[model samples]
Target: MRGLNKVTLIGNLGKDPEVQVLEGNVAVAKFSLATAETYRDKSGQPHTSTDWHSIVLWRGLAELAQAYLRKGSLIYLEGKLKARHYDDAAGVRHYVTEVVGEQLLLLDKKTGDALPPAT
Candidate 1:
């Protein structure tokens, strides 16, 4: 059986998405998402924690993100996890994992924009 690699996230954008156009006019967008969780400790004290994740979108989804998404925009993202390794200009090797966004939904009331499912 084939292994499954999928991820789903509901969070707010940490910053405006960075957009780039490749040689063939293909668009790509990259951004950070912040997800928060609340919990109660044994003493009944409530605490909140936040996690930040890197997100990547391609093609149509990338365009949509660039046009509508911005800092603090709430969204639902469905995608797969991808790990990549690269060497920086300083000759330092770096490994990073990011969510490759395939489907996106704008959950904020202001935009009310929800993109169609990814192809």
Candidate 2:
């Protein structure tokens, strides 16, 4: 039996995608996405909260992200959660978690913001 490790997110980009090319010319893009939720309290007051997630896109998806996505761009993404650990220069260990995007959809309309093809 295998366990499941999946994540789905629909949110706005907090910043432009940071694209990097590795030694083998493989492209990778990283960005922050903000998702907001609103709820009504018992006193009839509405409250809103936003969560920020670290997103990582690889290869073709990364190219698409570099070409189209930007700050405030709306997107829907499906991917698996990934966690990694590394040592810093000070020999301290650090852990990070990110959503490794497998599929992406540009939800923003084509006004000033042009939508890219699905990946």
Candidate 3:
């Protein structure tokens, strides 16, 4: 039996996607997404929680995100969790977990009065 490591999230981008090219000209996009959840507590009071997730997209997906996505853009991402460790300049080892996005969907709706797509 094989275990699964899948994550699905619908959230809004907290900032614009940062695209970087590696040594081999491979493109990588990194950004932060905020997911908000609202619910009622035991006391019948409303509570809202927002979780920020680090999202990473590679290659073609990265290019797509860089071209269309922007701050506050709503998106649906599906990916797996990846943990990376590295040593900072202060010689401190840091561990970061992020969602390595394999699939991305743009959920923003275009208004009728919006400008037409550039030719």
Candidate 4:
């Protein structure tokens, strides 16, 4: 019995990826992506809403993100949703939900000329 936890998103990076080298020399990158929607309200007034999501990429994907992705860069990401909780130094517990990216595609060819082509 398998339950699916997949997530797919096409959005712009809110900021440059923060990369870190962990134990075993593994690379990890963390960043935020912004997805926006524009809609008309019941009164026919147009409004725009933006949602921010945290994203995590590891190993090769992390390296690629660090190398190419930047703030406001459009990208396609496919991954799984992951939720975790951690206690801070002040003894407060924080819950976080993030996407653990497995596949990444740079979608802004106009601004991504330096990036490798999407495969």
Give the winner by TM-score.
Answer: 1
Candidate 3 lDDT over 10-113, as tens digits, reads 99999999999998999999999999999999999999999999999998888888888889988889999999999999999999999999888787786233
Best of the two (1, 2) by TM-score: 1
Q: Give the Å shift of residue 35 in candidate 3.
A: 0.6
Error of 3 at 5 (Å): 0.8
TM-score of each: 0.93, 0.92, 0.90, 0.92
Better of 1 and 4 by lDDT: 1
- Model 2, position 54, has a per-residue lDDT of 98
lDDT value for candidate 2? 0.93
**1-119: candidate 1 lDDT, tens digit per residue:** 89999899999999999999998999999999999999999999999999999999999999999888899999999999999999999999999999999899888887655555553
Clashing pairs in 3: none
Overall local distance difference test of candidate 3? 0.89
lDDT for model 4 comes to: 0.92
- Predicted candidate 4 versus true structure: per-residue lDDT over 1-119, tens digit per residue: 98999999999999999999999999999999999999999999999999999999999999999888989999999999999999999999999999999888899878626665331
Please write out the lDDT profile of model 2 over residues 6-105, one tens digit for every residue. Answer: 8999999999999999989999999999999999999999999999999999999999999989899999999999999999999999999999999998
Candidates ranked, most accurate by TM-score first: 1, 2, 4, 3
Q: Which ten residues in a row have the lowest lDDT in candidate 3?
A: 110-119
Q: Please state the error at residue 34 of candidate 1 in Å.
A: 0.3
